[model samples]
Target: MIPVTRRIAIDERELSETFVRASGPGGQNVNKVSTAVELRFDVAGSPNLPEEVRQRLARLAGRRLTLDGVLVLRADRFRTQERNREDALERLLGLIREAAVPPPPPRKATKPTRSSQIKRVDEKKRRGNVKGLRRGRIDHD
Candidate 1:
């Protein structure tokens, strides 16, 4: 099980990993080694993550979550495939950990103070006077 938060744990079986050749700047290793780790988690089908967490995860994943509800992450920074795999898993854990946090309650809206409203109007009037000076002579009077 991969621990996301203190309360949330993910079953490793739910995750699927595929290794592929990494693109860009790998030098000679770019063509020879398949070190890139593609980790896919089915956010919509996973029973391990709670519904609320899943919803938050999907939102937090943004572009990572595909139309089919798969959250895909690519890891290729490390040289060894094993290290890249671990890196991918850690990223997944971190993402879910972030989503597992309960969001703060919505704040109630309040009207501005009377003094603030008066100051805003005064500022607007001052700005108007400053710009009014720039007017052409045809309208200057």
Candidate 2:
């Protein structure tokens, strides 16, 4: 079980992981060993998550979430399989923890005060007057 928060814990069975060959830096070992870990979690179907958290997770996952509602995370920063696997799991936990947080309150709608509006108009008029004074008067004889 993966504990996301004080209230939320995810069952280990819900996670699926696959390993594939990783590119770069490992030389000959890179070609022979599969070090990259692909971790997948079914966010939409998870019984562990609250409905609100699920929605937020979907929004946060963005391109990482598949059409089938699975959240896929790829870990290839480490050369060893164990390190990559741990990295993947840690990333998954981080994401879940983030989703567990409550969203901020919606911003209250506000209108400009009458005094502020008048002040803005006054400033505009002042600027206009300054510009008008810059123009030389033409003598129409």
Q: Write the per-residue lDDT of candidate 2 for residues 29-128, one digit (tens) a residue.
A: 9989999999999999999999999998999999999999999999999988999999999998888889889989999999999999999998887777
lDDT of 1 by residue, 1-141 (tens): 877877888899999999999887879988998999999999999988889999999999999999999999999988889999999999999999988888999999999999999999988877777777777423222
Quote the lDDT for 80 in model 2. 89
- The most accurate candidate by TM-score is 2
Judge candidate 2 against the unseen true structure and give its global Cα lDDT, from 0 to 1. 0.91
Cα lDDT, model 2, residue 122: 86
What's the TM-score of each model vs. the native?
A: 0.74, 0.76
Error of 1 at 102 (Å): 1.5
Q: Which sections of candidate 2 miss by over 4 Å?
A: 109-141
Off by over 4 Å in 1: 109-141
